[model samples]
Target: MLSDVLRSVRLTGSMLFLVDATTPWRSWAPQTEAFRRVVLPGSQHMVSYHVVTRGRCWAGLRDAPPESFETGDVLVIPHGDAYFLANPPDARASYGPEEAVAFFRQMAAGELPSVVPEGGGGAQQTQFICGFLGCDRRPFNPVLASLPRMIHLRGATALDGAMRHLVDFALCELREPAPGGKDVQLRLAELMFIEVVRRCLTTMAATQAGWLAGLGEPMVARALTLLHGAPARHWTLAELATQAGASRSVLAERFVQFVGQPPMQYLIQWRMQLATRMLAEPGAKVSGVAAALGYQSESAFSRAFKKCAGAAPGGWRRQPSE
Candidate 1:
């Protein structure tokens, strides 16, 4: 399952703010790329999300029709594009970059679940929880690539009971900070994220074409599980097909049709992604990474990594940013 892959990739999460707003309120969150240094520093990719724990609000990316969301609704902005959440769908007010920078500063100062006044001082009515999930962009983030720019999971139907429970639990933890609350909240955020992805996958249409869609197919999903579960193992099409319970030709055709690449090509790309992450770590060695990823020699791994990552492993590690 994709959950297995998520575990392998190590997604970390934390709450950004637990906002309580009233009518005539609106706020904007800029792309997560802007907060790389302050929030989740060194994270190559960051995803922002909001859980409307109470009341109704409108949310969407810039210039798009704001989707209406009520209590229990969750909105995931996978690409970290700038977006706004507001009451009445037409609120012109927005939180700017200066406010965003200050917010992170406050968070860094140990003030979490920061309360900000919205709509020029009024009774706080609408309540929502906003947060971020951070994870490695390298090592093949299929979940990130599979998602659309925005995912709107309505409270009533899109999310299941488990997801709702998680939201409620997270809200409670946020409301009453206890010993180890930070760690608990972080784990809850990550679990909620995984639940959101799982729910989306369940409802995803068969016609949808992406990595998530590929998981719906038995053979392709099986192959994916095997590949993710043991990336270091040298695998051939025949071995994968046999393990996946399909013929080589059938597996190849379906895998390409769904995942947009042959099995071996996908494996090579996945290996390179992993190698980049490994090389980024302090004291990591090229030879160790190459051997770990089943490469016969460091030179071979360097060539493959260059082809996929557009630079040698050493050069990539030396660069200041991904």
Candidate 2:
């Protein structure tokens, strides 16, 4: 199941970057009903997400009021542009910038507040851990393009256990004194974000009733597994259909229905994504990566890669690394 997800994901982009909210740099307590902003000028703009670990908060997006968040929940604010993180819904449109900065400083100094007031309803103090999720915006990032502007993950549900573990692990890594701990935490956060998205995709059919509905199908899941398990293999409709336990015509129809593309179409896109990642890795070579991904020759791989990435493999190799 995981293998398919990985393969399906590669179709959109090659990299996943994570951030640990529990990092000492992120600890904060709301004082004056304001939202905290975490800016990532370097994010790819495909998606920006947050995972909650310690307490509750709200995320404000354009055209939407601030939404509530709780521990173990994940909030995806696509297009990592500036947004608001507030303690109360009413906190929007009235926060003072100076006071917000002062609150950030106070939290940095270990100040704690009790009884955070809620807007339009109740008053309560809320604590929260948040992080950023980064990914490419292209060919296969179906989740991002189809998702709403703001999403709320309900904590205290069956899905909370793994997500909570992810949050805690992220926190620990962020706080670790070990060398490169910060980098490790970020990578883990990216993985957690992908997992959280898949989990949400699983439930979206019931609650969301939108573009993610196809992701829940058994056949679609099978196809994803095959592609992820062997990106280098030469896949044909017949072989894919056989593996998926469906006839070619049926598989084609179903793949289109659920995955939003023909099986072979998805395969080509997925292969290019994998190639892009390999090209980006420090020591990888185009020829070696081409062979690994089942290309007959480097030239063949280069042609396909250029078609998708708008640059030849060698040219991509020469470009600045991400």
Candidate 3:
């Protein structure tokens, strides 16, 4: 079920670079939103990550105090927010979006993977395996919407072993640039992102109250599994509760508390999200999509689609792109 949600979001990972910098090294990696077209074109959202493969560095959002990241640490910016990386946490270095974009463009234009000195040319050494994952934000992106802006995973747990291996493999491929290296890095990045998400889910506190938190509850998780597994099925509250091993009232109360919506309401929204994606298919038809999503008629589906998406099904399908 979790895998299904990830697939539905259309995750694609791309390698950015393996940066080896000597301090006084400082640079700002701008928000992915600023260079989405150039970096991960066509993605609705971008997630940037850095794996500290060697030495140490200071990393954080531009306005906040920098957090020290050592070798094997993974720094994730889930929202693709702009952040600063420097040797000295408080170094007043300047790296603007224009400069960053141009640098990336040049890298994209056949630059070899090597240690490029950051504008600040100091002697301290720090290395990073940098990359980005692109995923759909439209229709639905529960995992992305639920995560914190920044997640720093220190490599001290079992999960870190697998993540480190992925990073290491990708880093090796990038450094050597063998045939099919790009594909290998991309696939590894996707797997690493999934691993990171799984790690987060396992460690998330029970007190949290978002979609991920909802998935942690026994009854709610069962209900979500059912909902995701069969989005096309016309499921009632009683049916869902029964399958979730709970009574209707209990399921309704807990589901609403954790998911912030009644089961039926969530189902409707989920169905609509699925519908939008289906409708975008090259040969998709309104009637076919309507029936597939449990709607009895095209007009009914249109009404529901408009209610959720602010546009009728036909209109939405006719749009240039989602």
Candidate 4:
């Protein structure tokens, strides 16, 4: 069953934060203790979110599906598409459009059956926290574009242990109502997301296809490393190709196929992504960011940044950045 499969996935692993300084939710629940996992049908672009404060849940994607998730595990459906989540050992018995609608209604009515429904099994009950993962789908998200519809990484890795503790700590903070509990939870959620991404990247690095493969390839990695290491270098195709030890055509083609963008394009985008990160830091100057990225003049950097990011560096820096 999908739920059982998901349980296995989540049980396999353990899974940090940005301070957005916002009010936390009035309530909290462990995904294992109190949450709902909804499965959406078809190709819609929506990811189901669950905060596992208590129990366990399952996450599925159209492609490259993830393992089950449990307490101390945070699942990220980057696309916000629908997937299955169930407590029953048999996911097939729980899935059907009509069953889903009823499930949601019962959930809304506080009547949705627990994973271990009465008389069904003596298995320990698991909880699931639910929410949404969304963003504007315009002007293209290359990262998302390269990713398959679904991705799951077991939280069992050594790297995810600290993240697990972070979630536990957040749960404790949420349990005690205080001046900034919500704020702390929100920040902790963001931290959790970063950790997941880190693990995903690591997984990708070891894979044969996907962005990690592209990024990990010695030639491509070299180009990416150089671009990231010193974006200020006036890199031409020839120089980049030389650095990557590939011909221009080979570099261009492989980068597009595996990395999801041409080398130069990837470099520009990566620089912008980094610049955005730096710009969000307190006291980080636009000129400083530009200089670090190899832009000699702020104006030149601004033009390039605007061209890629569709916003001025100063404006991007000013907003309570993502």
What digit string (tens of lDDT, one per residue) describes model 4 on residues 1-322?
A: 1122112112111111111111111111122211222322211233334445555544454343436666645555665455554443234332445554554445434343212222224354454434332232322344445455555555455225666676567555534546755445545554555455556666766664655566566777677666666666789999998887999998888777677778777667767766775776799999999999888899998998999878898876554312
TM per prediction: 0.90, 0.68, 0.91, 0.54
Q: Is candidate 1 or candidate 2 better by TM-score?
A: 1
On TM-score, the leading prediction is 3
- Give per-residue CA lDDT, model 1, range 87-116, as digits (tens): 867876756797786776566446855444
Give me the candidate number with maximum lDDT.
Answer: 1
Give the candidate order by descending TM-score.
3, 1, 2, 4
Question: How many backbone clashes can be found in candidate 2?
Answer: 10
State which candidate, 2 or 4, has the greater lDDT: 2
Better of 1 and 4 by lDDT: 1
**How far out, in Å, is residue 152 in model 2?**
1.3
Clashing pairs in 3: 23-122, 23-123, 24-122
lDDT of 2 by residue, 1-322 (tens): 4434344344222122222222112222232123222222222343545665555666656456667677666676654444665554445444456665564445323342211222333344444444444354543455565576666777755236667677667656544435755456556656676666767776675554333655577776687778767877888989988998999998888778766678787778778866766776798988898998899898998888888777898886676423
User: What TM-score should be assigned to candidate 4?
Assistant: 0.54
Residue 177 lDDT in candidate 3: 77
Colliding residue pairs in candidate 1: 139-273
| Predictions in order: lDDT | 0.79, 0.58, 0.78, 0.52
